[model samples]
Target: MYRVLRGRVNSVGFLPDERLIPYLELAGFVSAALIQTFDLRYNLISALVERWRPETHTFHFPCGECTITLEDVALQLGLPIDGNVVTGVSLISRPATLCYELLGHSPSEGKFTGLRFSWLKANFEHLSSTANEREVMQAARSYIMHLIGGVLMPDANDSMVHLMYLPLLSNLHNTRSYSWGSAVLAMLYRELCRTTDPSTMDIGGCLILLQLWALYRMPFLASISHQSYIFPLIHR
Candidate 1:
């Protein structure tokens, strides 16, 4: 048996301010924000990884072969799977400028390519009651950045999100144009393949989706009692 690696379940710790809801909805992440956190089954994830075949991107079981589909991403996470592909420059030449343009504030003098989650919370967690529309929109962008870094597509560092995604969120209405669901699915698939190596010690990406996918497709592996079906299956 392969050793079970620790799954990184970085749940979004803070809820978006009320003013941010409309922007979140427009960005296609409102359903994702509604997902409640659950305990990650590390052993189950490890077992599944052991059976993963990177060549085909499917789990090989004694019964048959199966894989997480784009439809699963759409239903489970309530993200749009069809749209412009999620692509951007990973390196930011002017992080400060980008932050100021979208977030209305920039980190103090330092070489920074990413915005730390702590900094985002410290600066934008609380929107002033008398703030103008632009300030509210800026705060909303920070919240989505938090969601992306902490929950959706976090990497090994797990503390900051690259500024690349900030520019994409500049126009809230167009945020939904990118296939966020497909990007998430691709990240999860890549992580699953990487963790198949026995020496791997940590897992990243949305393990919640992976766990829920397993439970739904293989009922025998699930222990939760039946609940009323919800639009985004993650809620159940």
Candidate 2:
């Protein structure tokens, strides 16, 4: 959230949350420790931004018809997604194992946890086809707040009250197949742009733009966390 907000406020506007790895380049051990300890996937989001730059050559057809399937997209991005938009995958939660890693112990090599995107797909289907960027961002924002809430407690007045849990570390294997968090986010962005120009629907870029609206850690959040955050629940 902090990264996304900063990215929006910066001169380049919003771009892949400003590359967290760059700041940690000197601390390889810390980076390695973080990966082992938390299995965080934000790094992958940054990498996707780099690879899918507008000027960069991509397999995605911008000027022509979008003949690509979701499976192809998942494979191209190295995301561990499977099945189609109809059926969903399963991911195993591993918060306890992640806790162990922080205590100088290795995480259990258990199965990865997941969430379903079928409902997301259904939700996407129901969202107004003419949905604007702001609407997309609002959806992303609630999902993020709900995700954090699931890790501990549901946001008391959060919009996404249906979310019960989110995976930890190893459970967040790849975007969708791991936890379906980023996958659903990316899906929302994609669905919103379906009828629009392919060039404008740059997946990574669009996702970052949407993420800016999901800002939970802006500079002023300290002042508003207790009161302003509890806006009327948006049921998208």
Candidate 3:
């Protein structure tokens, strides 16, 4: 499966030219490790940001589709994903294993833990520089946070709560701070209904769309992460 992505135009380059490899590598690894460790498929997790791809030749993933959840991922992996979007991670919490696999380390061959942090930090700094970088960085961070909260801190109130709250808060606000806020909100609300009471639909879904009304003034929510640099390129 990993081989299928090789020499594929480096889709990430469209967002952050310099940081593409590191983020892509981490994404591919996380997707792969999650698939193997928890038996989830890459398409589900990949689908989250896949819809926001710019109309450029460099990016390869699909765009403008429904939001993919950790639950869908777990279901695809054949794991018992129940109770909310996060409850799926309790089945396999192995950061060390996931990090090792992503960095190409073998279990008997010791661990490559430091490489994981180094890669993330380097890419983080590299991605914080411009508009496009900010969007892509946030997306990547959101993905990592999903893995961390779903798998490692499944019930942890801090990160998981914040993760859920961000979409809610963003939807309520007037500024389109992030391009995918609505998409993320949709997924969060769905999970809210799935894991809790069916009646939650009234609150989660309503709150999300209501907040997203503020997005009318903000068009960059979908492509803002990488568009900062793209506009100049187009104008030139």
Candidate 4:
């Protein structure tokens, strides 16, 4: 599939194949629509990048005393071993608000990163004040937690989760600011909370990814997502 896509960059099937125009505008719209109903909005590069952004990506915190080992939180929550899915989702979904978990404080941290704070910062720093952004991050986190708990929570809507994957992926790739990352994650969680079915699928994919990469738990691979079925030896 990837090869076919690469070979046919000019196929017009993708759209706007014009030199100055970004193919993402055309491709992204189509891609977003296809997975718009799902939780994570999977696409080859965007999905992998979103799923991997936390560990591989690092950031410089200017003035926040927020630092928590994500692994510890998952342990406390008893949600399997802290792997890429949990860690990545936590960071992305909670963003700077997660810093409170590390700061030995609570109410203040919540106040600092809540929608009000996000909104205040949005005008000045242009961070994550958008209502749409908040919705998406919330949904992503909601999806992750429900998966661990073996349940699905209701959601508000699917547009943000559906449309914002690539944008979030792009942001993660282009920025080093931790605040931005947190804001994006919160929005993602909100989107996940909007629907039950998508939340199930999203969490299912995360568990499968975790089993394959983290605990070396492979048996679940056959039952979760299709990606695990790829036999490295055969390809090699």
Candidate 2 accuracy as TM-score: 0.22
Better of 1 and 3 by TM-score: 1
List the global CA lDDT of all models. Answer: 0.81, 0.28, 0.30, 0.25
Relative to the true structure, candidate 1 reaches a TM of: 0.89
Candidate 3 local lDDT, 1-236, one digit each (tens): 11101110101111323444344343332332133233222222222212223232122322322333434333332222332232123222443454333322222344322222223333443444454643554544434433333332233132221223222112112112222323333444443333233232121222212122212223343344233342332222
TM-score of every candidate:
0.89, 0.22, 0.24, 0.19
lDDT of 4: 0.25
Off by over 4 Å in 4: 1-175, 197-219, 222-224, 227-236
| Per-model tally of clashing residue pairs | 0, 4, 11, 28
Tens digits of per-residue lDDT for model 4, 1-99:
211000000011112112212222222121211211222213321222222323323211232222223342233222222112212332234434442
lDDT of 2 by residue, 115-228 (tens): 223332233323355655444433333233223322212222222222223222222212133423344334434433331333332222223222222232133322432442
With candidate 4 superimposed using the best TM-score fit, by how many Å does residue 166's alpha carbon deviate from the native? 15
Candidate 2 overall Cα lDDT vs. reference? Answer: 0.28
lDDT of candidate 1 over 141-188, digit per residue (tens): 988887787778878868788778898999989999999999999999
> How far does residue 163 in candidate 1 sit from its true spot (Å)?
1.2
